[model samples]
Target: MTSRSEILREKMEELIAVGALAPGQHLDETELAARFGVSRTPIRETLIQLASMGLVVMRPRRGALVAELGPHQLVEMFEVMSELEATCSRLAARRMTPADHVRLLAAHLACREARDASDPDAYYYKNEAFHEAIYAGSHNQFLLEQTRNLYRRLRPYRRLQLRVRDRVGASYEEHDGLVQAILAGDGDRAEQLTRSHVMIQGQRFADLMASLPQLAAGELLAPGAAGRTRREGAPAP
Candidate 1:
């Protein structure tokens, strides 16, 4: 990434981290450039990239804004996300090299260590590592890129929803299943496992919307997720 692009990306993530760029808020290019001591050109380019990732919306003439995340949109996104991950897992089973297998197993072990230590933050990174390993193992550039983009787009929501009761434990178990499926080269099972992995969040988000109807309009899972059970009926891989 260019320095300006890197700066803009970091600042944008910071805005999300803070409450400055809450969901649905328009991104002011002029104001952001001035605040970050950068030029508008890089900001514009970065905004376009963010728009492609489904994190921002670029209107024809109205400039860019954070994407509005209603429950319906969340459901749609999660559905797509689950399909993409399932594809990744299916591909990984056939394409993964020995090195890829080792790296994925290491990620699973890291998650086990993180869970044993009760470190949620570390577990999050380890969880990411596990998914990324599978993405790389898939050996499809397009699928890998799309999977990564959606993962980043959903990061904030995952962090929020996973804070529900024993969600971290459940997430770790899912990771274990993924590792097992990959090591065994079970393409069908791998795809099934990953599809369920992502749809569980959608189910939680739906339940959350049911409990807090306010979230049905703006953001999908904020102000606490109601945390439903994992989606029980994912499609067969």
Candidate 2:
């Protein structure tokens, strides 16, 4: 794929994350090309990459569609994400440079602005910068890469969680303590705080559930998922 496809892929990812391209929605390459002012070639390439990421599905005769992710599957991903981020936090506590500390604090304070405004979308973007500073501070390239991939993949749900009533303020409070723990170089506390901060469980899970717009249980479970994949092949000759 070319650089054009790469950019398109990210844009499409955002549409899916925001529910503009709802789960199980059909993706029409010809129409998409016209809408995005690009050729079908790049659109096809973008869909192929998204399919590999499990964010889309390619059907043998039916073109492509968005993949569905059920709540259970989403929770499983969040569980793993929490563990990875906790590890990053642990390492960051011991490894962050003074400059890294500066950036981290800057990002954290930026979240406060969004919190004061009570804008979940604004907080979501700022929160990403804050978490990313910690990820980079981990000083482990492999760990950083893995943590980021999962972070990117689970972003939609994380964004959704922030929309719960008063969640923006609570998340800011969580970050306040987490930033303190990391800044103090308290690895154990930082790790514990990250686990608590990122994991969706109990009341937090309920909050996420409540935040979801009404949809069928099965769809919620595996919304627009590629449960019916059948690889394309030429008809028998």
| Candidate no. 1 TM-score | 0.77
lDDT of 1 by residue, 200-230 (tens): 5555765555533332233433332222211
Candidate 2 lDDT, 112-225, residue by residue in tens: 998998777668778888888899899998998888777766766787788678889999999999999999999999999999999898999988877666321222222332
User: Model 2: number of clashes?
Assistant: 7
TM-score between model 2 and native? 0.87
lDDT of each: 0.71, 0.79
* Candidate 1 Cα misplacement greater than 4 A, ranges: 1-3, 10-20, 59-63, 201-203, 207-237
Query: Between which residue pairs do clashes occur in model 2?
Result: 67-224, 68-223, 68-224, 68-225, 70-220, 70-221, 70-222
Best by lDDT: 2
